[model samples]
Target: MIVAVRRSLRRALLVAGRDLTVERRQPDGLVAALTFTVTLIFVESLAVGPVEARRPVIAAALFWIALLFAAILGATRSLERELEDDALDGILLLAGGRDALFAGKTLALAATLGIVALAGGSLALVLFDLTVALPFHLVLGVALGVIALPPVVVLDTLLALRLRARALLVPILALPVLVPQLVAATQGTAAALSGDAAASLGWSGMLLAFAIAYTGIGLTIVPAAIE
Candidate 1:
């Protein structure tokens, strides 16, 4: 079982490596995502004024929105790149298991979103002067939200792959599907900002369930998408 798990992890990482290599060779995807996120945060700060930006309620919404839009942009581009190069088909063939391919792509997307979330969170802290008494829960909420991205991205990617208007379709398809996650993340952040562990914990549980359900469904549908 251990060996099998290791092999599975190795295969997933191999697929992830392919994504990272492509990302490295053409850095535009990362650059665009980072730029968009930073710009949105800065604009919001400017509009709301740094002092007002510090409000826990407003800050929670902004943080989730920034991360949500940024993730959508990044995931769409990443999947579109595969489609454009016909690389996804190749991966599907070579991997011999659509579940593995889905897992790998989902991992890569989540990793990228994790980086974006970190940067966005830090920027929020600095720009908004956001103060939250519950540091641990705040961090936990961010971590949970970050972990939830993979399955969402995987499902969205499959849906967006063949859509004629992917830019529009991605957000349309992803936004509604992602509402529960956004709510959980926002509530968790809000709870942490207000120093309420119970609320944070509640949302964390919901977020975990969302991740599991989304991933399971994504994996189930990926074989059909690949075909």
Candidate 2:
């Protein structure tokens, strides 16, 4: 049992490492996600127009919204690399099962989205002049939200793998499922900014719950769906 578990862990890490390495070499997805997110935040900040009272709430909303779109775009691009190279089958075989592949993809995507979230959050803070009253909650909210999003995105990407309009369907399918996380992240950030620790914790807890649920579903469904 120990050996089997170790093997699985090794395979998962290998898969994740491969994906990250490819991303390091290519970086198209990362570049695109960051550019889009930064641009969205900048444009929205301009529209907010020097309104200090309004910046907190609007900044929270805009940060999460931009992150949401980044998640979709980045995940789609990451999955597309496998399809473009006809590598999905090979990866599944090497990984020994779909669960490990799912896990590795989730980890790689989580890392990618983490960078985008950090960039977006920093930009939001500077551009909106947003103050973080509860820094812990704000960071926790972003971390949990980033961790929670990738599994759903991976599953959605695989489900839409054979679709004719995959680019369109990916977001359409993922947005509804991701609304809870989005809401929690936004509300949590708002709470943190407003110095409501209780509320921030509540929303962060919700984000954690959704993260578990989404990742569990992804592991359970991905194997069957991929085959």
The TM-scores of all predictions, comma-separated, are: 0.91, 0.93
Tens digit per residue, CA lDDT, model 2, 96-117: 6688888888888899999999
Poorest 10 consecutive residues of model 2 by lDDT? 48-57
Q: What is the number of residue pairs that collide in model 2?
A: 0
Q: Cα lDDT of all candidates, in order?
A: 0.81, 0.85
Candidate 1 similarity to native, TM-score: 0.91
| Model 1 per-residue lDDT at 147 | 74
**Candidate 2 positional error at 15, Å:** 1.4
Top model by lDDT, which number?
Answer: 2
Give one clash count per candidate, in the order shown. Answer: 0, 0
Q: After superposition, how far is residue 28 of candidate 2 from its true place, in Å?
A: 0.7
Q: Alpha carbon lDDT of residue 23, candidate 1?
A: 79
**Per-residue lDDT of 67 in model 2:** 85
